[model samples]
Target chain A: MIRSKIPLRTLAVLASPALLLPVAAADDYRDYRAEAMAMVKRDFQAKGIAGLDRLEQDGVQAVCNRTGNHPPADVVRRLEQDQMASVRFPADGKLMGDWKEGEKLAQNGRGFTWTDKPGLPVGGNCYNCHQISPKEGSYGTVGPSLYLFGKKRGYGEDIQKYVYSKIYNAKAYNLCSEMPRFGYIGALQEQQIRHLVALLLDPESPVNQ
Target chain B: MRARFILAATAGIALAMPVLAQTGASADFQKFRDVMEEDNPAELFEARGEAYWKTPSGPKHASLEQCDLGLGPGVVAGAYVQMPRYFADVDKVMDAESRVVHCMVTLQGLTYEAVTRQPFSNQSGTPAHVNVVTYVAGQSRNMPIAVPQRHPKEREMYQIGKEIFNFRAGPYDFACATCHGTDGKRIRMQDLPNLTRPEGAIKAVQGWPGYRMTGGLMLTSQWRMNDCFRQQRFPEPKYLSDTVTAILTYQAVNAKGQIYRGPGIKR
Candidate 1:
């Protein structure tokens, strides 16, 4: 194993106090928004699976961007309601899928880079931001740990639906969440989302254990 | 029978060692970086870059020896740290790589398209431009970053860059801020730099044109920013776009006065 880099990095930063000047005030150049957007349009080239359309910020995204992910509470409430309306539940009314498959998807963080092939199954990438299964040592702390989610919340249909919708479009519950609208963005299929829900709420899953 | 059983156990332990090693891989990688720093492979690229700067082979048969890198014509020392500053000649602020590209085009009579055609080095080989940047960066080793905000355009680029850093978009809803806006956080185990801060911002400026050990390819910050947007699931920003310069400016300005160790190796 390599040695700790934090101390070395810290020492380097400590070696230069005179050079660490305060950042320029960000008060001005709010007017650059239009120009910046224009630059984004001009400078960014769509390649492979990532299209120019990806740059198009929807109303929700625009609000989030403009507010620094801190839109006024009222705006957040309304936007979150709108987001909730966009979550399409499976007509079959079944929410949970195989936990084993969901576990695999959580562990798999590969997909959606420009180099990735289209039409392939996308991973849920749950473990990248949340702790779900106790066995996972490398889970990120971006989102809350969902370990024992079903054990704590119960294995009811309502909770299952909540988990399903949350995975599909997280902004429905909380606007400006770092969590992606996985199903809304068409990154995860309804069944894939269902599997994720099971991974969180299935009593037999490692998450509950 | 005992000998056979002992051999099987030893083999099993050997097989399990890699898993144990993976647990401490980050620390191991840091140790590897420490050891490798003394005899970095980046110096080889720096030497080649120096040669490229002096060599004349493009359509005009001119060398980048006469190229002005904001400091003045043909002055390579400490130039990397003072850019993405505004260039009066080009009427735009340029980072080290873009300036190298400009010189390759303007001085050597190469087309922008041709020079940047395979701008980044790949498995096949290191690009001339990437090496050029390495050489330029090497000249600025141990020099302070002074990314200028003296010119109106330079100031404007810094402001625009700040916006881009915080601007959230794409399938992931990630801005550069999402991962890098905070400290003591990691996507997995890899620490994310708080790019908004001085200490954190320097990380972005340091060690590029880096010799990436994984592919053994030399890469510049242009590739770094482009790849960041790609990983953010956003469309690729064109090579040497103002959007990128703006972001680089913001980081550099934040990191102003910090010492750049020049071209270094990466994991």
Candidate 2:
């Protein structure tokens, strides 16, 4: 009877190890994201144009990641308000720039990639999402067609402000908006964004005609 | 002078012949129908999407089984092919993705910001909204398009979209028709579909809400139009704005009777 009881005790101890295995595995998965983030921090080297800071998440991105881009209404509104506040309008009060320059910027979806040099102007990459001009045959349709942006919206001050703000900080309106915040991060200058606004809102521009 | 003129004429013909021959060869090679027949990766997205639709999610801990997809609610099959349609509940015309958002908000009780805030990938995560869109768009594959323009609102949107499509501007003097108006045009090996024609419009419109091979992004139809405007050097379109819906309505209505085959894989 003593030998049999000893065997039972050993079995109980052995069973304990097996039970802990699942818990360990669960912990690993829970920490997987954290481990990955740490690994990226250690391994990723920010070179010339590309900075390590790019990996850093802002408040909006942090919330977006946590909630999977479906944050609660109150949270989204708060975050969007914060983003809106970050937008700095031009001191000169000029919102419209040359449409010709804007056209060039839109078509040129270059810059900001690792291969690009710092200080060079980044392309708006708008064509990557919109159908603006009628002439360009190759255009992506990630966003809506703004062919008659000015004509349909009416080129009023309210429209101008909306266009300016939209280009400046798309996230201000839609927190998880796919449209890049051209002016918010300084990827585009005020002048460049203004030109973009003009390209869309100027009545004399071909978009209206 | 006569001899020189003859020499020039002969040289021109010599240069033109090869160009014409190359053009002819490419025209023969441009049959995308053959490529589409074998297998479409969009089918894969659809399968994954189906799994997601039935999967339980959200803080509420429920599946989207009760979610409505514009066919009298809780009916997802063949709904995507006829999207950008009018919805009385929202008092507006909504597209596939937008309608999905509506369901997520109304049925799932997820906030609009949460649903629309991120790009599809980020929103989708392990069980993401991207997969849901893929699943929804897949349901309409091979179904003939039949946009409901019977509604006054729908008709109005189509007119607005047509005006937007034809509106030309910018330094390049471009309109949507500039690149897509003609029957045969291409930019660097990519064929430009003439959206005016039903076949071309169906092919073009149906393929969107697709996975872009180049950027490795799952793009929606709204994103497609926005990208076109960007290329045209115009300002970006607002997310889910009426303008974008109008354009979608125009394309869908024009593509009436054509089968839907989308949320396609694109290069």
Candidate 3:
């Protein structure tokens, strides 16, 4: 009876002071990010959904990590073009999907954790870093609030394309942007990016409201 | 798919509900933390650990009486804060856990493989190495934090640690900075330590080898690192590996003057 009443995951969230740690490393102001990656490659092994290849930074990550996320203008211009060239748009040329599905994907933060089942579907985790739908009360502040993404940015074809490409490869627009190259790595599929595009660019979407 | 959907819905509402709940929940959590600290259960582990340190129970039938924790032999006090230090015997930098394993092998004649197993804890109480490490950390409470960086290898460890702290990988592309790195950021109600600054770094690293109240367990920095990597979605680091000490060196040097206050309780 107790087992029936209780959830299986009652233990996962228990006493998690690991993240609540208040310590930060001082800016030794050293270029150790590359060496750190080498150490990680040697120190860590692959398990489940997470693998060794994840340690291998793409061109964008290599440049960003090396420069402390602050590259020179010339470097940024060249790299941004390189990143933007990587986005593969849908063959159909349509750039919108169901907003309701988009809302679900944006709200969901489950995916790609080592504990997660391999090859299972992943969530967008958008709310972990951005505000998407206005109704979703809790949103992270790592990025600018996107509650009026469509309204403020102007919901146009170019806007739709911009939103689509940005979500696909954020570094494509701004070199060394903290946002992951979501579309660049296929973390989200073509349709999923389209759905996310709708969530951000559709006037009817709660993000616009 | 259905389970995922249901879980997503549950998570959505859970994240959504807090704005309405406001500050009341936070106050209750704070009160709960205060009560938990009023009497730390980690002391039990410390007691058992103290016994393990003194009592002879190895192939050599020896106690760790002569084991040097960078504070000479058998001097437990203030040794933990200066750990992850370079030891001439092994010719490498080691954190508290690795140093214990080294002592266990040479002083007590235990096998490295057994003492350095994958998971630090078991279904049965705490592992021998973990208990000893936990006890040692308890001895250094209130001592000023001072992990050594004199040796070239020690300095190398610190540099490597800086990178690992910011190393972002895996499917989600999350790194330590994904949650931390900002001045004031939190996941839900939990505070995310900005591990790049002194004030934040001291509070984050000092209070480990802590007791987790919900699970009724004593945790070493090794276990804490293991849990963090798991949460960060990376495979586990081998126990007492160079990677582990490197990370510790980075944290310790940052919190150089902050008084240690751990073997503390966690909510």
Candidate 4:
């Protein structure tokens, strides 16, 4: 009778909430999320250019999911400290790249959709959250305005390192930052990130002007 | 054989008639224009905005009724239609949102950091700053765009904005002009407005400081510009900076004579 009332899959989905108890609060929130994720996983069929692996959560994502956006301050600090260690600076200590190329990269939001090829590079989609150039009329405001980022911040060694690390792993600076880690996930190469640094920090770049 | 040929020709004509009719239907934007005229929700936002204008808030418990927006103090009507203009007080050209921030900081004593800290919402939550912007933009709805270009600084900014619009570089080798420079371009179901044309500029510029249904956020024109740069893979632009004002001026001036009907709703 119980089996008839609820399907096997539904029961499994409902039971997933108990798994998250030790990490997050035992409130109905985690339970509801687990049930929702189960339903999502069941319905989401990986087609061409999409894969089932996307449904799996990484360590950082799992932590973020459990904590919502505002995790404990100490926990965030610890997590960010660990993330900072993962940043890989260039071997020769070079951080700057061609601003022209970096400008091109910042404007592009294309790539990584299911329609895209797996081997091809993914776009940084920075403009989705930031204001980068003076010329662009259509920009989203999720992150801080990055215009004159180099000018206001100063084009110094500290600034260069900060920009490089920020692009490499935004979470290293702000634990729950909305910015994606371009270098961390290999979405952007070291050279590409460096170019972006130059785009932001170069005195001659439009950003500084 | 001759009879068969005639029948085939008549059949072809019948098939082509509907295609020709469909093209004719979209040849003019009468239907689209009518759809826009019927009920603009931005007007409703504007009404709420006007109420907020008179209402007092902040630590000083002051109302924005006396705030100046370049036209002089206490004028709310038609301000949105002529924004991203040079203001002598600030000594820099400001877009609508930035100018609002300046007024709020000066009149209401709200800090620029505080106003910008939570500029707009990508979610439903009001987020005080966005409420203020929504109200301001609403006051200018239905007014014709007349961004002042008399100042040398304003003209220089407009030129910079134009240069930026046409400057093409990226992996995709795309510029804003690549997709929006021409007439009749659509990505998926969304029709890209021609930023260069008067009609397109009005339709595009006015809708900003708009509530995006998809993102569930109330975005300012500056935010809109930032997103465009991001999609283009350009570096992030500053919020409400001179550059953004320049670009907005360029769009506003290009849309000159078109009636302002924004902060409109968008999909």
Candidate 5:
């Protein structure tokens, strides 16, 4: 029934033009990507804080996007290493801060949008994607639940540093994780990341309780 | 023994409180939506739209009876399902909303700025263009989507739309794919549609030009796309631009064979 509805002459016309295109232009997704990027850049007008640079892809983003978030193992390893190297741990070497402050950061989901003010402390936006505190009635499940994070994985110095690093630059561990690079993007400060680490690792925190 | 049983039952309800709170609203919303579907308020907007289509107004004092919606001048049925097509008169492809705006400008002598000044309805009132789109979409009820790929420009738009879907940038490094590329995943309780496939794409295209019960305002797909970019923390795209038309074309073509249940109600 569906076949009967299609105009055969129109299909034939559609086939011819596509056939006449050059082989490189016909099959390359890159050409279309370039054209689409150009269109996006053209059609969107910069307003408030969201500048044209927001549309620009960094090196890591470019690789993940081109490969559909599955870059070659060698490239992933190299990029991951670079991302890991980008993390600047606090000079004082304290990886843990007040969980009370961390809880506030986790609850906040604002910053860096066109509507937000610049130079203000940004939010961790943790609850938007991770089940952080069991007491929180509404939490997202984009990432695995971090309930009992410290209880499950012993509250040690190694684990504390790992949590700090992960929040600072998630791409260091997974190349294309949906979790944002909170600290690396300048969206979170050094103290802010420490508070989040404390939230995950502090035994007294609700996540561990 | 009776006291013990009552205490245990109280404990059970306390333990279940969070789970209940989470699912309770959505379940209640589902019931409300079912009731609304039987007699949607979108009909009021549709009736208003028909009045707009027939009434002679605007600067030229002309009605839109002679407006070509791709079927022909004054032909409205099934045109919504087959639009975002190439119009030879303009020599560019246009979506249903864009085409309606064009007619309002050319036939009714309404300035583009004036017509699109308030493209979306708000707490104040519903826009005429949104009502017109709802009315046009209603004419295509239960029809199979057949957005044409006959034009070279139309096919190019589909390709461009595919690229835009996968393009990642901005502060969070999110594309539409981050939330919507995968199946059986969600943010909070809201289920995300994997628009790369047909089943998922159909979900994206379904029930648009709908009346949202939350604000009691009518909305179109154009407003939805605009909100997505806003949520992604990107700058807004110009109204009736090629960027938005490309994305609409991509979704519509992907959902080609799905039945359109026109002018829906949303919670």
Candidate 6:
């Protein structure tokens, strides 16, 4: 429907060429994250795809949020272990998919907003945080560039499994990662993650070029 | 193979800013803003709102001449800059929109829902409240923003608003902080001010009740808050909700000393 998230989507659309005079909302500089959570839950509604359940932080979100995305090492280790346990890998041994499809998913940032029609495909929005392919001129710096994923890391089945699992649940690897848990949250499927893995690891993929 | 694809995907995310002289789009937007400021269609709303305020037409067949903007009855001048204040009669803090709806209900004999219905403007028609907002906001143009916090409720609202501003939620995991809390960030050519800090918040807040060039709609602070949340993928806030007012108070108070300079012209 793309109707529910009118506010957020409008801002997102406008920001592309929008000029709201750029204002920052202000400080979590102090750790009042718990207080913020209560107010966040109270103020915002959970309509359609954006249910109140999303507001309820899982263990990963809880640890990351409570500490302003900086949970202690021991806590991160335990939580990361728990998150890893939640990743449901494909039943079949196959873990690779089309890099072309993966590139489309990585490029798409639509989905998860309350307005998005349910069951429609969601995108990884990878470029919003990383520079995956050199061909693209604009990419975000929120995450490190993966311009040569397979080239730098070496192409191996071990690498493929790691990439697959990582996309499934980034928190499993980094407790407070700014990246979303695409597979863990069901935003992406096994096939989709396979494609994304290929997007990075496939030697023929532009990313490796 | 990778070389040609990035060109098509270059527009994927709207990040970064270039100055007016630096880029074609920025230069165009700057020109549009300047032209609109010289002759803003938003001023028409102000004129209509003034008429709506003075002319008696509600079920009560009375005017909003008795409406108090925390500056006594019917005092529109310089009243907007101090909005999102605690109203004793309603027992809550209200921004300009809330105050207008309150008057429409109390004096005009309109139902709360009727007044709030069609709260935002589209290509077709402007909302009744928007006209009143434009009128009220125009009256305070060039005045310094001095949103009050003397009342306990008002103070509470400000604190709540600050928290709301920081509270992150939704699919993309965006809080207002995701895009706005940081400095030197942009979603395309538009500059993002750090609302957490007084300096940044003032510049951003100062522009609302503005005339949007893209749609030629006059937007208010209420609309601003509403739109921001929509983009956050949160549920639509009720018209004049405490949460809405609280967020306004937070932005307003941060912008206390800046000259209230709207119904502004915006890209």
DockQ winner: 5
For residue A116, give model 2's deviation from the true position in Å: 11
Tens digits of per-residue lDDT for model 4, B1-267: 555455455544654686544233232233333354345555555566677678887767888888777788888777878787888886777776777777778878888888787655655465555666788777776788898899876876776667556544322233566557766554322456788999888767866776655655666777787777555544455566555666677788999999876576655
lDDT of 2 by residue, A127-158 (tens): 76577877664565546778989989898878
Question: Would you list the C-alpha lDDT of every candidate in the order shown?
Answer: 0.82, 0.66, 0.74, 0.67, 0.83, 0.74
TM-score of chain B of each: 0.89, 0.81, 0.86, 0.81, 0.88, 0.87
Q: Which ten residues in a row are the worst by lDDT in model 3 chain A?
A: A1-10
In lDDT terms, how accurate is model 6? 0.74
Residue-level lDDT of model 5, residues B1-267, one tens digit each, is 555455455555655688555555444544555556668899999999999999999999999999899989999999999988999899988999999999999999999999999989899898898888899999998898899999889999999988888888887888888887877665665667788877888777777888888899999999888888877878788888899999989988988888888888897
lDDT of 6 by residue, A103-136 (tens): 9988887776667788857878888767888887
Against the true structure, candidate 4 reaches a TM-score of 0.51
> Model 5 — TM-score against the truth?
0.86
What does candidate 6 score on TM?
A: 0.79
- In model 3, pairs of residues that clash are A23-B200, A23-B201, A23-B204, A24-B194, A24-B195, A24-B196, A24-B201, A25-B195, A25-B196, A168-A183
Quality of model 3 by C-alpha lDDT = 0.74
Model 5, position A207, has a per-residue lDDT of: 93
- The sequence of per-residue lDDT tens digits that candidate 1 reaches over residues B146-227 is 8878899998898888888888877777888888888655676665678888898898888787888888888899999989
Q: What is the DockQ of candidate 6?
A: 0.21
Candidate 3 lDDT by residue in tens digits, A114-185: 777866357887887776786876666677778888889898889888988999888778876767667776
lDDT of 5: 0.83
TM-score of each: 0.86, 0.51, 0.82, 0.51, 0.86, 0.79
Listed for every candidate in order, the interface RMSD values in angstroms are 4.9, 18.8, 5.3, 18.4, 5.9, 3.9
Across B193-236, the per-residue lDDT of candidate 2 in tens digits comes to 78888988986786676765555566677768766765544444
List the candidate 5 regions with Cα displacement exceeding 4 Å: A1-30, B1-28
Which CAPRI category fits model 6? incorrect
